[model samples]
Target: MSKTVTVSDQTGTEALAAQLAAVAKPGDVILMHGTLGMGKSAFCRAFIRAVANNPHEEVPSPTFTLVQIYELDRLPVWHFDLYRLSDPEEIHELDIEDAFADAVSLIEWPDRLEYLTPENRLDIHIEPGSNPDGRVFILEPSGDDWIKRIDQLSRDQA
Candidate 1:
């Protein structure tokens, strides 16, 4: 299933992330796609903060680092930025298979790892709108569980 949300500001984005955090489970894979300055990193920051239950926690983009692992409320959250990757095979060296087995993975610039990403992942496309600070979030669920969750989220927000 698919749904779209309009986030007016960073606060709204954080709120949305918090809501998602409340329901997200281990083994969840979120693939985020967007251009530079499209708030992809901002959303990741909010998500990690909410999951960790520590708003003060630092959530930096792992563009150069490839992946950053965060211990959130004792649960592992793996944030991966594949923007700098030259090939998806390079991900093998990061031991991502084991990470995927246990943690919730959030990937930025997931297109670079399309072949490696799971088939049941959640795909999110963030787009810049006509107005500054406005963003259009397109969410597509790749599996039955996420599809149901997306539908529920849509109804709850509506």
Candidate 2:
């Protein structure tokens, strides 16, 4: 199942992330796609905040750093930014397989990675609308688990 959400601002994006965080579990992979300045990092920040139950926790974009690992209530959240990566081989050097094996991963610019295979992933596409604050978020499920989860999430929201 798939779902689409329209967010008007950063707060709405955060609220959506928080809602997802409540249902997200270990071993889940989230693939985010959007142009620059589309609030992908902002959504990630909110997701981590909700998962960690720490709204004040600083979740910065791992642009230059590549990946950032956060321990939230004993669950490891791995956030990856591949915007600066020019080669897919560079991702292999980062040993992302290990991170995927141990924690939940939120990957930005996943299109840059060639070695990774998404098993159970929630694919998010964010598009800018006519209004500056308006955004169109399209959620696509990549596996059976996500299909069910997304369906449930949508139904619950309804």
Candidate 2 has what TM-score? 0.91
Give Cα distance to truth, residue 64, candidate 2, Å.
0.9
Q: Which lDDT tens digits does candidate 1 get at residues 82-102?
A: 889888889998878877789
Model 2 deviation from the true structure expressed as Cα RMSD, one decimal place:
2.1
lDDT of 2: 0.83
Clashes, model 2: 0
Q: Which candidate achieves the best TM-score against the true structure?
A: 1
Off by over 4 Å in 1: 154-158
In model 2, the runs with Cα more than 4 Å from the true position are 154-158
Q: In order, what lDDT does every prediction score?
A: 0.83, 0.83
Pairs of residues clashing in candidate 2: none
- For model 2, state the Cα shift of residue 11 in Å: 1.4
